[model samples]
Target: MADPLSPFRSSLLPVGVRELAPHANPVTAILMGRGGSLRLHLHGARVEGDMLLIRPGVVHGVVLPTRGADIIYLNGLDFPSDAPLAEALEGKLAQLAGGALEGGRDAVDELRACLAASASATLPSVADVVRAIYDDPMRRMPQGELALRLGLERTKALRCFKAVTGQGFREFKLWSAVQYAAAQMKEGALVRTAAMDAGFADTAHLSRVFRRVFGLTPSAAIAGLSVN
Candidate 1:
């Protein structure tokens, strides 16, 4: 699928029967095991089911068979709440259950439809700012500079950002950067390089935040092997 949004990215991971450390994302993540099932610990809550929807920053620990399972990363969409969005996601799950990767591609249309349905009512107040961050998370200008660019006061900008994303701008920036770095690691980037590129102070910093947010170290996630 051609993602015109440019910022949003999605991919299917390798297939296997495996378990990895519990991890959280800075962006929306759709996780489903084979047969559209999963054993999950979400935000310290135990949930086992056919599918699980994780919002940005929600901690999730997954346990799979000795082999491993596949993962699909869905980014650039807000957490779905309204019926249309929910139904669309459920539809995608149905596609997965049917044993078709087509669902992953089809998800783009569903996401757009849901986005429209949600926007038909009222969109987030800071839609433009949010889009900028969503587009290039690493390029977030300083609050003062961003405020000037948006032609708003810094305080107003902060409030708008928080109201729309339910995250402090600084925190959101960090999460976005860290997730990008993690993605680099998944793609085989060295820890040092990923840290530098993702705007982290150092590998140790990435390791600390990564462990705190995802409940596992970077290497552990890469190996897809963890004890708990």
Candidate 2:
């Protein structure tokens, strides 16, 4: 089966009603309930809503609605660092959560539009780096070489990448690898094969990273899901 999520620049997944263990997401994301409201536990505090905007690096777990949910993972480089992104996005979520959006893909489009309207233009060099990583998660590109390519000092390059993506360069690379592995798994690859394809040291390494970032083992998250 073709990758259902291939057309999307941001990763979007439709998940059935389930519980996700607490984990620190590497990128900003939004979870919208499909047929009912959602309950999120953030830092031991609980909040219930039809839509929830998740900030990067926050430890949170969710109780999805009975019908299911649509999760949209965003590129943090698209938004301005100083803006109140969560508040603004929550407002848009409020508008869309009322059944205004059709599905996960449509929700992604709406959210992309919202971000584009207010986001700052990305730096050319930083954008290039992001493109390269997304294009080939398995590529070995060290920060020093990247800085040289961008005509920047290594420290400046690092700072610029973090500023644009809201994640350190290393963190972004790890997230890309995880996404790559997940994509391979969606295509029916075994955990070991997917781990190797994504450049992880081994299945155990992939499992640890996956759990820390997503709060679930790869098998638990990908098994039984219909990619088609």
Candidate 3:
């Protein structure tokens, strides 16, 4: 199957976190409840709910107990409105929260479907650039290098990239790197290993960026995992 999250999918991680310190993701993040509620702290906007559509670079933290959740990431899309996408997936997530174990996977799959159904066609030039970056998300991506690769003037490339992804080249690179590293942590990789794999200068560097973007130390986020 074609990856439903091509070009614009940021990170799709499992949720139901006991607690997450304040953090920000570079892309839009949709946290949907599987079968429980969460008390969220989104940069001082406290709300408890089954779903939230966080815009790009938004700072938010959540506490999940008992019920599982799926965190969906979006690079960018032309949704008519975020409401329908959130509403449709909210039902699927609520099902999972209602003890529909089978629905857990279903919810995620359907969430992708829901997003894909509403995804706007990305412009070819922008798609080429974004897809390249995503293909090697952990690679050091300088704006000038990206411009050369895309065969466009540095200034034009910068403008075009921002126009499509709504993020500057450097900003997207940092987000992509952090996003990749966080996924590795979920799989039981040590902070150091994840940091190295994600192209950080070192664990301390990764920790700093991780703490800033996630509002919690990398150690804290990895605490929930058992290395297998």
TM-score of every model versus the real structure = 0.68, 0.80, 0.74
Model 3, position 181: C-alpha lDDT score: 91
The deviation in Å at residue 31 for candidate 1 is: 0.9
Q: Model 2, 90: alpha-carbon shift in Å?
A: 7.6
Q: Candidate 1, 119: how far from true, in Å?
A: 2.5
Residue pairs clashing, model 3: 8-75, 22-214, 22-215, 23-214, 24-213, 34-96, 34-97, 35-97
- Clash number by candidate, in order: 8, 0, 8
2 versus 3: better TM-score goes to = 2
Give lDDT tens digits, candidate 3, residues 39-135.
Answer: 6675455766766655555466777765545666656633324442222235644453332222354454455455454445567767777777767
Q: Give the Cα RMSD of candidate 3.
A: 4.6
Runs in model 2 lying further than 4 Å from the true structure: 1-8, 77-110, 224-228
Name the runs in model 3 displaced over 4 angstroms: 1-5, 15-17, 33-35, 42-44, 66-69, 78-89, 92-119, 226-228
TM-score winner: 2
Against the true structure, candidate 3 reaches a TM-score of 0.74
Scored by lDDT, model 2 comes in at 0.69
TM-score of decoy 2: 0.80
Which lDDT value does model 1 have at 158? 82
